[model samples]
Target: MSVSIDKTNSVVLSADHITKTIGAKNIVDNLSFDIHQGEIVGLLGPNGAGKTTTIRMIVGLIQMSKGDVKVCGHSVRHQFVKAIRHIGGIIENPEFYPYMSGFDNLKQYQRMSEGVTESRIHEVIKLVGLQDAIHKKVRAYSLGMRQRLGIAQALLHEPSILILDEPTNGLDPAGIREMRDYLKLIAREEGIAILVSSHLLSEMELMCSRVIVIQEGKLVTERSIGSEVQTDQVTISFRVNKTQPALEAVHQLNDVRVIGTDTNRSEIILQLKEEIIPQIIKILGDADVSIYRIEESKQSLEEEFLKWTGGNRIA
Candidate 1:
């Protein structure tokens, strides 16, 4: 599916029909998407689903056999130096010099990248909430502190895009929450587009605005997670006097699936469109089944992810 971006060219990162092939196998097939400024997008798929391969191609770690990746209007393949300047990324765990102080570590990176001023470094240090510990040695810093320092280093050059792979790995609950909030803040305050990849579906739900799901190296679906029920289809639990009759009546509706049923309690859970709820009630009433109560529940991201991945465990 094609994602529509703003016509004003607000897209900071775009993978246009990106494909990766290894010998006879196609790892990524015609994958395309856009991440606009101030947006946080999640790259999600089951293990061996080409999530890493796609990310690697975007960062120019591996070459794409076909198609293109553009960052800030510069082609990654043709204008490697120009395109790379707009991106700040942390692939897997971020590395740091354990003997060096956090401030010194950032200063060292400042030397590697042109145009990183000392004030910008301090600004990013404050942005990541490491002001008090900026002088502390990396060896004395916790995993979360090091992660924040990595982010600060990435931000020093003021890149337009940030890509993080499994950024919350090895973090505690509190640390994870801190990382999530900081990322959102950066996307908003810095007006930068951020793309994150992780196996934690629940955390992705909380952190990402939209998610792209790919399966077996193909795009399965892309969806928004801000609303409880983002799609037209919803899961509703119906309580009635006769479970058999209600089930029989609901089965008559098109595009409806009966997922769970309890005969003793006369309850049945169905996945269908919200607009079809009234029709279902009429059908059950016409069937002479006394309707007790109907409750609509939002499908969690993990449930939707499983549905898209065909029950494959996301790793």
Candidate 2:
């Protein structure tokens, strides 16, 4: 959310340098970013990183008090209908007639959509891997199935740009994996640009080609998936024979922060990088601290979210 919209997505869907005020507070301030074509860009921040506001602006769901936005060369302010026609989104949980069959619900949507057709409806159902369950009533569908249906509807019209927020929140592991693979496939095959927002770091790391991090309604960091962020800290978890000698060896290392200790598992999270890990292991081994195993722990998306949001309480 804080990441300035760069020419990231390979195609620019929406662009802005705008501000929004609700009563006495300015929720979004001078925010600017780009979502390029056919790229999966991530918007991650604390719970309220102006993510929803930005999404709203792109979709013309909310009018920006200032600045300009264009989608596929149509102005969001002047050519709202035309610009929005180029986009598709599922901001929160999509609403549906609870008693309707999934196929019927999609039919209702298809009937109302300006150009989407029955075959397109079938295409999306298959793409979402919901063929077996689509005929089932919405009431019988699991939460994950419902979420997939939401995505199905978003994809129904074949818009050039897609947006999904917290897409994996309630999904089981299998559902999450399926959705990730499907999104990647469509992005490549259809050349559609995508912007996905989530609190789950690993999921974003897996699903996104690039990520834009936000915190406290402000921009924090925007980076590609493998882009290195300076940790200012590194952690190594290992199983060793003795605890005391391990502790002593780590303490001897300069500026190491010994966060925890135990008989079998001692966690030494120091302010360093992966480069120093070998030296630490060698020091402990020479001192007879028989190493069981050592590894660099990967931070979850939530942890990265917290760190980038300055660990601030979400307002």
Best-fitting candidate, scored by TM-score: 1
**What lDDT is reached at residue 257 by model 1?**
62
- How far off is residue 42 in model 2, in Å? 1.2
* lDDT of the structure predicted as candidate 1: 0.84
Steric clashes per prediction:
0, 11
Q: What is the lDDT of residue 58 in candidate 2?
A: 74
Candidate 1 residue 291 Cα shift, in angstroms, is 27
Task: Count steric clashes of candidate 2.
Answer: 11
Candidate 1: worst 10 consecutive residues by lDDT? 1-10
Model 1 lDDT per residue over 65-154, tens place = 999999999999999999999999998788899999999999999989999998999899988999999999999999999999999988
Query: To one decimal, what is the Cα RMSD in angstroms of model 2 from the true structure?
Result: 11.6
Regions of candidate 1 where Cα sits further than 4 Å from its true position: 5-9, 227-297
Score each candidate by Cα lDDT: 0.84, 0.72
TM-score of each: 0.78, 0.71
